[model samples]
Target: MSAVLDKPRAKAKPKAAKSALQTRLDAIFSNLKLGQEKLQLAHQSVEMTDPGEAAEVLLRTVIEDMLPASIAPMRREPLARADVDAAYTGMFPALAAMEGVIALSIGQVIEATLREAFAHLDAANAWMDFTEMGDVLPHREDITEADRSDNDLAARQPAAAETENVAGCIFDAYERTIEAFAILDSRVSDMNSGAAYGARSLVKVAVDATSAADETNTRDNCEHASCALHEAIEVLTLVTDEAPDLAAEGALALLVLAKQLLDDNVGALP
Candidate 1:
């Protein structure tokens, strides 16, 4: 009786392995669902904010949060907004001088993030495939023959559609993320250009306002144009301070890379 019971228990091993593989596949689907929900929240956040504030918030978010979340931890501290801005100011003879450097550096960051994102995506797909196919490992010949006819037929028909749907969802999330990053890059470029031009314009306005002040350069109540330009500058200052969430995600990711580089070469200037 003991020998017979042991024999039956041994035969149940393949079934147990198959059940484990199915469980893993379920977990993969659960994670995919959670990822999709997070993507939706990100999209809603972008859609809700005003453009300038949105841009600033996005920039801050990328630099401070999203990047760190994405990458492996580094020993060095990430570059803060003050650090990047100070670097921007110091490196440029004028704000306009920063155009090329900002474009190139930020562009590279965007590209690298997209590359890493795709790599992550491919890894996820590989895992999903493993979970889906692993059950056949034990009863290879029988499973193969059975799946060959049945799965082949279904795979060519409904299974193909199902696979495409899953792939589409995955690709859609990735594409949207990349697009968000691109928008952020564009926003930063625009904001920099606007600030440069605005600064030059403000200087001219100030000079005119000064000249008009009593002709002796002593004044009390400011003129209309100067006051307006000053107000504009204030708005821009607020913008710089705020930083948009979408841009923040990308910026944070770049800083994570920067942190890694910094950690490897300690005490090096950024």
Candidate 2:
């Protein structure tokens, strides 16, 4: 007991501090995670609002608030040309913010993150043209029956079968895009190759293609959709070529499915 009491206790070692670079990286990742969460919340809010009500809600809650906060200051003083240019440039951040929200919403749709099928329904609405089709015939009470008939035909909504086909192509492409992103996200550490940014570039291409697909689908532009989906497939091919390990069998299968859908529907008018 006396010998044990005489033994000295070892001092605890101090924890090593994180390097400045590592600390910055940590902060960046944390901010990115927070940003993602915020985007998700905004997407949810958009989804919860009815399509008819969305415009009103957005105007009241977002645009109205922003206009006062951002533009009210300028109204207090007569703006010089320089001030006007500065204000114009400053609006870009708001534009970018809107674009980010829209992108995230589209991405979530592609990922099938939303529980409802309303997203697909909304996409399908693109094929339903509400406007009168064909050139505005001369506004005359003496319009011929043939002209009216042609106008009615031109204004007709797309054939259900055709709409379904295009929708299937878009859906398949979106699903594959989601898979592609999943693979890239898993291998984010390899996004940058020593000096080449092949993976990162392909990722951008994939995102752009998905966005194009969404926009074209909304416009019922099948040709553009086909091209976009083709680009998406090309991205998958690039991903496979650059990092075969990341191109899992499931992803390849989805790619094949997407390609088949596109092939079947290519050249078909919306």
Can you list the residue pairs that collide in candidate 2? Answer: none
lDDT, model 1, position 124: 34
Per-residue CA lDDT of model 1 for 1-270, tens digit only, reads: 688766754334544445765564455445434433443343344336533333333433333333322321111123122322333232212111112113323443233433333233333333444333533334323445655566446435632443344323223222323333343345555556555345334434433443343132122312332353344335434444564333323332332222222222222211
State in Å the error of residue 164, model 1: 12
User: Which tens-of-lDDT digit does each residue in 1-270 have in candidate 2?
Assistant: 799888998888988999653453354335333433443555455646533232222222223222223322222222223322343343332333233224324444322322222232222222122133222223323456775565445434333443466756666555555554454454445445531244434544655655566456653444454455456556555655665432222233344444444555655534
lDDT of each: 0.35, 0.41
What is the lDDT, from 0 to 100, of the residue 49 in candidate 2?
Answer: 55
Top candidate by lDDT? 2
TM-score for every candidate vs. truth?
0.25, 0.31
Candidate 2, residue 37: lDDT: 47
Model 1 segments beyond 4 Å from truth? 1-23, 48-146, 158-270
